[model samples]
Structures are given as structure tokens and as C-alpha cells.
Target: MSDGKEMRRPGGRSARVRAAVHQATLELLEERRWEEISIPLVAERAGVHQATLYRRWGTMPALLDDVVDEWSSTTAALPDTGTLRGDLEVYAAAVAAPLQDSLVPLILRAVVLEIRPGEPRTPSRAFRERERQLQAMLDRARDRGEQVPTLAELLEVVVAPLYFYALFSVPLPAADAGRLVDRLLGLVGQKA
Candidate 1:
């Protein structure tokens, strides 16, 4: 493993270093706020030099963005259950699974900070891309004769409360979060 070659890819040492750095970043986030995280700290935790982290991620925000992007991409494929409730429950389960990870709540907290007090919040480009993928799953239910709502403005409504509750207090247990997903999915129009 020390050779730094990942069998699945060709990037070798650089890739291994990047993975180690990201893993260290996540480990640190479990114990500190994003603002408190620094390249030097990440390098120290990762056992790499500070120059390595800076060379790879450039800035704190850039590093944070990569971490979030990796998280979003690693999730399992969204389920298609024909019924909106079932489909959403599957989606919720995948989402809720990460909430149990100590690092995840911190990440969620950081995301909330990205919002401004009195402005129309725009989804980050990565988030928008991920949402489009989710929406495509929703569209599949529609194609299968399930009723689907006009989702142009409903994305935030669906996810905001979940994040709010998790970031604030009493993070919803996985089972409870599943129930919330079921309830929220019910609110969306579903075919009989």
C-alpha cells in the first residue's frame, strides 16, 4: 500500500496522497468546524507536507468543495419503486445513512453557513448537478404513471427541514429519518 498505487486507477502516488488528504480532512471535520480546518492541519493529519495539500486543493473552500463532491458521488444509486413514497424512502435511507457518520453533521453545518441572511439562495453548482440527477429519478416515477408535482421550486422545501433538524439538535435517527422521508414523500402527489 505504501507504493501509493491504487489498483483501480493509474494516478499512483498523487492519487494516494489525495485520498489520504481527503480522508484526513473528513476525520478533522468530525472534531472541528470548517473554519477551524487548515491545510497545515490536514497535512499533519494526513502525514503529508503542507505543500502537498496546498498544491492539490489550493484553498479551504476548494478543499471543502472536493470533499462534498466526493460525498455526493459516492452514494448508491437512487431507488425507483414506482410509488413516490417508496422511491423517496430509499433516497432518504441513503441520505440518512451518512448522518450517522460524525463528520457528516459538521459538513451539513458548513453547508448552512453558505447561505446568506437576506438573499435568494442559489444552489451550488455541484448541488444543482446532483439535484438534477435526483430529479431524473423522480421523472422516472412520472413516466411509470405515477403522479409527480411541478418540482421547479420544491427541492429546497424537501431537503431544508431535514438538514435544519440534523444541524441543530437531536439528529434524527436513521429509522426516524426514514419515516420523515415517507411522510414527505406522501405530501407529494402520488398515483393510486
Candidate 2:
């Protein structure tokens, strides 16, 4: 029976293509600035047609947004261990690990600072989502009778310093994670 509607083929081909493209993007990011990497370069690196990339990703910002989303999906997540301190320790380790990745600062700068011409500054809201996740976690602690401060306060005391040290190429002192977690807990009336 022939129907008017066309049925697309079902396969894992799209997944394979996305993996190839995203991996190629990571490789390119290591050697190229966000503005310098084009669709042709990504396609050549991935062994895919430029047209395919253009069709699939739509624009350079869109593609980069997707790449960053993939990276965050794989790496960035809030810790949900039974207690707040355990959760913060888990997140702190992640921050330290990624700070050493050469690409991390560059990617962070581009996503946070660069405004793509003719497009939204952030096609992905990874930063905002991360903040929201932090807020939700804090809200949970507050619900559990912990006196948590606002997210802004938490960031000022706990998160910003790590980022500052990372941006300046300073190695995180081994005690920094525990110290910051303690300070954050202290703000929430939880003595560590």
C-alpha cells in the first residue's frame, strides 16, 4: 500500500553522525578559536558533507551551542548525595578537574562573552540552567531546616573564587574544595 506521506528510514545513523561531528568539534576547539572554526572545517574534520552540517546545525552559533550542550550533558551536573556537603564536594571536584582542561576557559569565555552577529548571544542557556540547578539544591537544603543564603551569596563565597583561580591559571589548593564547602555550609547555618 502506497501512502502519500513519506516515511524516513529509522537507524542509529543520526547518533553516529552527531558523535562524529561533536568529537570533531572538540578537536577543532583545541586548536581554533570559536570564531575561526567554520562549517567546512568541522565537516572536513568529521568526514561529513558541509551541506549536512549546515542542514543539521543551521548556523555556527547554533552548532557551537549544540556542542557545548553535549559537553555539559556529559560532564556538568549537580550532585545529589544525601547531604549538602557531600553534594558540594562532588561538584567542587568537577570544577577542579575541568579547570585543568585547556579548552574549558576558552569555551567558557566564548559562551559567556561573545555575541554572535545576527543571532542570540547564547543559543544555549547552560549557565542559567546551572544557576537554577544550584538554586534548586539550595532550596532543598532550606526545606530541610538549613539556613541557606541566596544563590548570589553562595556564588560569591564558594564558586567565584575557584573560577577566579582557574582563570588566572592558579592550581586549586588541595584544601580549597573542603574549605569552600565548609564556608558554604556555614552560610547555611550548617557547621562543617
Candidate 3:
């Protein structure tokens, strides 16, 4: 993590280097695939020496993981409205707004280009983390006497379409988003 340069460390030199490296990685990712990005490129982009990037991240995968984790964590926490409908609407807005971000499409497109169909695809840690968040939301709803089908199914039926439309260039009208939310709450009500 030293990057061979003595950085003043109030927070510590390592933290500073990591932040710089992440910023550089994110900038590079906007224009190139992960495979095309090299350690030297990251170091150059960050204005650090190449050894520093290696010392901090060790490999491209490690660097990209840190970048994605940092990016994913920036989303605001979902609101907990009393009703399921209200909560879903708030959550939908949070989820949908991110879809409109330019970087999201770039990252998703990079991922798609990197993976071939029929290849065994590992689920991203972010995807699992999001599912966990949704599950927690479901648990909260249940605790509030609001029972619903498994959050996975509900998310697949509702939230997944928003992302799918964004990725595939399908038109996701506000009415469609509202209808999906209605269907999700309808399912919840039926289950209750």
C-alpha cells in the first residue's frame, strides 16, 4: 500500500492511496473494459507509480472489486414507510434513479461484454447484498403484520424489470413502474 511514495498520513497514507487508486480505476472503467485496463494504466491515471497500484490492489480483479463496492455503497438507504405500498414506491425510486446514472450502464455493458453466454456466471456480491437488503425489508414488513411472498420473487417480478429495461433499452414508462409496484403489493395483499 506504500506505493513507494511517502504520503502524509493524518488518516494514513494507505487510505489516501486506496482512494486515489479507486478514483483512477473508476475513471478508466468509464472508457475501457476491465481486461483492457492495466496496472500501469491505473497508476498513471492516479498519478502514482505502477508499484503503488500493485501493492494496494495486487491484481485487476481486486482493484475492480473495490471500485464496484465503493460505487454500490453510495446509494442512499431506503425509507421505511408504514405501508408496503409506500415502502415499495420509495424503494423503487431509489432503485430506478440509479438506473438512469450514466456510469451504471457503462459498468453493466462492460460486464455483459466480458461474459459470454452459457458461461457459468457467478452472482456479483452487490447482487447478493441487494437481495439481503430486500429480504430485510420483507422481514420488517412481516414484523409490521405485513406478510408477502418471498422477497426474491417479489423483486424478480418488480425491481428486476426496471433494471432489465434500463440495460436492454426497453421503454419503462412511469405507468409501467407503477403497475409493477401495484402487482407486487397486490401479491403481498393476497398473501396476507
RMSD of each: 4.3, 4.2, 4.0
Give me the candidate number with maximum lDDT: 2
Query: Tens digit of lDDT per residue, candidate 1, span 15-84?
Result: 7887898899878877776678888998899999897678778877778777777766665456767776
lDDT of all predictions, in order shown?
0.68, 0.74, 0.69
- Which of 1 and 3 is ahead in TM-score? 1
Give the TM-score comparing model 2 with the true structure, all chains together. Answer: 0.79
Compute the lDDT for candidate 3: 0.69
**lDDT of the structure predicted as candidate 1:** 0.68
Candidate 3 backbone overlaps, count: 1
Q: Clashes in model 3: which pairs?
A: 3-52
Between which residue pairs do clashes occur in model 2?
A: none
Output the number of the TM-score-best candidate: 2
| Ranking of all predicted structures according to lDDT, beginning with the best and ending with the worst | 2, 3, 1
What is the Cα-based TM-score of model 1? 0.78
Cα misplacement distance, residue 154 of candidate 2 (Å): 1.7
